[model samples]
Target: MAGGAAHRRPLAGALAALAALSACSLFVGVGALSPRMLLDEPDAVALMLASRLPRTLAVLLAGSGLAIAGLVMQTMARNRFVEPSTAGTMQGAALGILLVTILAPGASILAKAAAATATALATTSLFLAMIHRLPPTQPFLVPLFGLVYGGVIGAGVTYVAWQADLLQLIEIWLNGEFSGVLRGRYELLWLTAACVALTWWVADRLTIMSLGREASVGLGVDYAGMLRVGLVIVSGVSALTVVVVGAIPFVGLVVPALVSRLAGDNLRSTIPLVGLCGAMLVLVCDMAGRLLRYPYEIPVGTVLGVVGALAFLAILHAGPRHG
Candidate 1:
């Protein structure tokens, strides 16, 4: 009971902090909003509903989805460092977006999202295949290989964008920001919520798969099928995030690492906490971006990159256990 209380305390604290940050996010913008204004001013109400509310929702959904995606990837790959951005999934999505832009200039948003999801899945599969080819003892090599593979994919996308005069569009996708997330604009991110729920439902299978193929098979688990499903979840979340708010790096990588440190690796128990921690991290970063320049804003992706890189380095320095 004491141990349970201890666990709930931190979860409660995180939730409280998230709620406070969310409230601040709703009120802290160029157009000031206050309790009084919400009741008295029509513009305040409209802005809150149309912009601030959507942005906050986007932050929560994107953060939670990416963090869950990271946990899934880490468990499946049995590597702590591997996540969507580092594993080329984001770049693949970018390539998909670029292809859609060039090939079907009039493509609908759903079509673009489908293309991105397909490409992300393909690239993630390639990364997994490469990992399978290498010795299992050198787990670090997987993330390193993913970094290089993603860079190659990114370079290809950049070259194509440059040639096609679509660099601006690609740039927007690369630098993730929620400033553009108004009501209709950010509805796609709700898909991430559904994905996260689906992931939660399969947490037990994922946990089993993380125990390695022999262990999974010993327990009568279909290791290959579970791996495929995990990959699909990661790819879908990554592609949706890229298509909706651009590539917000490091949330997946950093949030899961932090959550594991606080809550341990029991995915069934920790998935909710992982989602909350991820949402909190992104919310804090987004708030910081808004405050940094007042009227102007730094991209949330930029803030998270600097912060996530530092945290990632610290994790590396600590030499996380593979377990």
Candidate 2:
């Protein structure tokens, strides 16, 4: 109770900062719009509505979705270091997207998202089964196998992309960048928002399932059923995020972990906060990418990739201390 009370002010401050940063994000793009004219000028209104609004929405949805997915992945794996990336889920989704591009060239965005989600869920289930079969004492083996598995799939996709003569397009698909987002193209992210809502709805069940399969079953929960539901939701969210903002690696891993640190591991209470933190991180990184180079823009994905890698190392160094 005392801890939750202490977090109130800090959490409020974080929310305000995120909201302010997201507002600024709407005006910081490569356009002539000014904050003052956001509502008054027709041209500014048009640009804000047609471009910035949807982009902003996409950022929120995708950020929240990935954060929730990370939260679930870490909880289920019982390892703070684990996430969709470490579990081979995102790699599987990427491979699915690549396969779609090859098999059904010029497929609709919805089709691609569906393929990615299905592949991610399937791969995560396989990884989980493999890990579950291992002795409980050998916990590290699961993540190690997952890491190597994801690497192999990633390498395979890269090779295929190189051979397809569509390497550039495929590369663009994985490189997290929100710059290319526009009204029609970004509607796909709404699916991510929907997934976030669903996560909240199932938050309590997920929390119980995270307690270990035996505990969950002991508590009258359908352990396998709950796990599948959680993973499917996570995969769908992650895949849509990848489709929208490319791969903002570690947002899911970092944001939810940070939230759990400050707010405790109550998934029911932490969902929105994780989302806000994720949005703030991406918004900050995106602005930094734009401002650092001025005329020469660096993609938000690249900046995040570099920063995420450093953060991942820091988390590794910090070890279970942070957890």
Candidate 3:
């Protein structure tokens, strides 16, 4: 009982911090708007509705969704370092987006998203098939293979973009930013948010699946179907995020690894904390990007890349120690 209370306390604290940061996020952009202006200035309210609110919501949804998706990927692969960005999922989505942009420039956002999601799903499935063939004794090989696989896919995408002269546009998808998120721009992330909830509902089966495929089948958890579900969630979330805000790497890799240290592998309770930390990490980075440059803005993806890269190395150094 006391242990449960202790756990709840940190979650509650994280929730409070996220709420506070979200409020500050609204006031950071170049426009002169604030909570004070909303009472009397119609423009402030319109600006709030049109831009600030949507951006904040996008950050929350994308961050939380990615974190949950990462957790699901880790649970399925039984590898801490494997996630969308490392597993070719994001690269495949980038490929789909590039193809649509080149072949059907007139495609609607939904069509483009569909293509990206399809390719991302395919890539994730292929990665899983490859992982299945590898011996489980060397778990580290999964991540090493994923990194090489994703790099190859990413290189191909870059080459295509260069040949097509879409390299500049593709950069936006490579490094995520929330500046373009307005009222109508980011609603698709809601679907991924719903996916996160579904993950929570099936969290127990996922935890059991983490033990291994044989163990999951022995426990009557329908391992194949659940693996597909997790793949879809991971792919959908990764594709939508790239389509909307671009690829923000290492959220999946770092957040879950850190969360595991604090909470162990019982995803039912830890998922919420993971989601909260993800949201806070992105929000804080976004805010820093705004303040560090004053009038100009750095992409949140750049800030996170710097931070996530350092964290990634730290995780690499410490992983064997933990194991």
Q: Native-vs-model 3 lDDT? A: 0.89
TM-score of each: 0.97, 0.92, 0.96
| Candidate 3: tens digits of C-alpha lDDT, residues 100-193 | 9999999998898899999999999999999888877777888889999999999999999999999998899989999899999999889888
lDDT of 1 by residue, 71-128 (tens): 9988877888889999999999999999999999999888898999999999999888
Of 2 and 3, which scores higher on lDDT?
A: 3
TM-score (C-alpha, index-matched) for candidate 3: 0.96
**Which pairs clash in model 1?**
none
Candidate 2 per-residue C-alpha lDDT over 99-189 given as tens digits, one digit per residue, 9 for 90 to 100: 8989998898889999999998988888777776766566556667878987887788789888887777656766777778888988888
For model 1, what is the alpha-carbon lDDT of residue 213? 95
**Winner on lDDT (1 vs 2):** 1
Question: Which prediction has more favorable TM-score, 1 or 2?
Answer: 1
- In terms of TM-score, the best-performing candidate is 1
Q: Worst 10-residue stretch by lDDT in candidate 2? A: 1-10
Candidate lDDT (C-alpha), each: 0.89, 0.79, 0.89
Q: Rank the candidates by lDDT, best first.
A: 3, 1, 2
